[model samples]
Target: MRLRLSALATRPWLVALLIGLAAQALFAFHLDRPGGIMFDEVHYVPAAKALIELSGPRNIEHPLLGKELIALGMDLLGDNPFGWRLVPSLAGTATVLGVFTFLMVLMRGRMRVAVTGAALAMLNQSLFVQARTAMLDIFLGAFLLWGLVFLLWAMRGTRGQVLWRWCVGAALLGLATAVKWAAAPYIALVALAFVAIRLRDARRAHRPLAAALLSGDQPHWPGLPSLAGLALLGAISISVYFATFTPTFFYLTGATDGLSGLLHLQREMYAAQVQVLPHHNYQSDWWSWPLILRPIWFFYAWDHGAQRGVLLIGNPVIMWGGLVAVLVAYAVSFRGRALRPLALALLWTFSVAIYAIIPKSLGFYYYYHLSAIFLCLVLPVTFDHFDRTRDRGWEEWYVALALVCFGYFYPILSAAPLDGPMAFAHWTWFPGWR
Candidate 1:
């Protein structure tokens, strides 16, 4: 057993591939369940159909890429439950793989840490429910995560390959924003991080910033192009964002003409998105999201002589335990001056911080999905912090505990038949959840 574990740990790419395939299978299983549109599918799926028919845009408050993907899926798969949800399920699988790759790179191919983090990502309930639904978050999340992955790759790539890697990263970031405006802050963060790193390197090297930009010889951070070059990379993302609106140009009546029309559409979307709305039964404050204080019920129904529902709640084992893991990881990183773990912790913070400053009047638990993923990364570092004694046996047991919790909650997360009509009551552990 020890030999097998050791061998697998040495093959991080294989572990990531296996994890990705398993996630894809799990997400694809029984994806047509509940027999109809459950929650937000009521909004986006129809817009997709509308897009396919050159009908008017129905859900114009958001960008077009997510709906476009849904339309593409339906176009290929014949417009049923399978078609509507295929893209999200695939996106979800990509998210799990992205999480694994991010950890592998960040931790320098620490396979155990990457595997543990990726396992936690699968066990995190929010991803499962969101993946099965036709919502936009998972799509945006996959792009954002892979975008970060490429950014990390750019940092370490050979000089010949760095510029293209950086451009690919920037373009993916733009695709994320094209899916949802929520990705705007992350794009800004990427650009700002590039500028900050270049400026810092210039100061340390005692060279003028312009000289550094022109030389394109960033020591310790090779391959990153000049500031003007990066701005053009940023334009790549903006152009990608603009290109997704091409389908909107074909709309029967409200066809967007060009750059001016796209700008008009964006203003209209901003107004629609920011306008205050009535209270929601499952609406939650940004602070309560990490606590799992309230979870949105994507679907709850009695069908085929059985009762079942899908709840967008995080696995308590991870949600509650991750809070402690983050704090411990923080203390350990700060004490040891570990920059990598600190970076993971900060990424988690910024993911949540986007919500705290957004102009939207109401928020829901699903908004916490991105931050919950970061917790997966943070939890593994916490384990590494304590594994100084070289006993990795505990990590396996921890993953086992998470797996048990996932099994216990599987019926609720996946819309599987429940034991009785009040089965949902058993899963709702708090008043807010009710």
Candidate 2:
């Protein structure tokens, strides 16, 4: 039994995952801190509380899965700050695990680089800030990150592996979408990427294009699904998404009209989302995201004679360095002509378009988390191909710089007691960040 436990402990990604989980717990779970209602907690926590009572949900603009998870945490831990914030904190840890394993896969078991990637992801202000709050985006972001990773694995897997991964990925994608419609772009991207991979594979075979796709590549793709089988995966996703709203089915809210209310509720939510709000202190244009400008202020308080604030900013090193790494990835992929790297570049480009076209009047720094997750994939994956000494030097600087940025910005991200309002404001190096 001891030997078995020791063997299990040595499995890949376990140490990295434990480190991430522990670190996230430290940052998030507070017995007596950030102890009152937070920015969006005002919306999500109460909805979750109402969910526990079988009362009507207060917010219908977003879906039920995230609130249900919050309710579950509240049930397990009671309705307090730690209780309400619990699931998101775990989701944040899961996201760190996702990033770790994702880089592990791409780098072919280079554990150190993968761990560094996870550290970068963990320290990023967007994840850190969202993890500590009861909010929708972290849940959405975590699901999408894992779902995207699973989709990539499914696409690359052989035989029964492909089928199982796709099935799991579909369900995860569904869960991601259920948390918020913001994940729709990722869902669509993964679906398109799946189809594209199959279509490309079909060209190598002499079979009919549709049949080749449905049948999957063999010898190379034994035991993979047919068209009907793929449809089943999609159905599983739809079912999971619908099932998350089971509570809604039992109790009608302003969003849900009745048994046939799902469609009406969806339309109403879409309408609400698209309407413009011209005035907000921190709203940003899409152009600013690449530069990490204009972080949205999510919360502020003057309690017990101390000032506090929560800002959705990205770590400068990760955001700015990752941007440079993206261009490098594009160059390396184009020059090396690597299939996966090329796909990563295309996905990043695609995300920029998706971000630009969103109809919301406000886009904020936090929305860039999706781009950041994808960019996280680029650095480690590219770093693996670099010469040994240079790779070491680069990663050393990357980790040190990212950690320094995290330290500099922690007061603002966590709402730690400040000397005054401007104490946190002083951390903003750029005029635009203010």
TM-score (C-alpha) between model 1 and the true structure: 0.95
Q: What is the lDDT of residue 145 in candidate 2?
A: 78
lDDT of each: 0.85, 0.74
- Model 2 Cα lDDT, one tens digit per residue, 350-414: 87778778888777667777777767676666665574345345666778888888888887787
Which regions of candidate 1 fall more than 4 Å away from where they truly are? 9-11, 203-214
Query: Which candidate tops TM-score?
Result: 1
Tell me each candidate's TM-score: 0.95, 0.90
lDDT tens per residue, model 1, 347-418: 888898888899999998988888888888888877876783587676778888999999988998888998
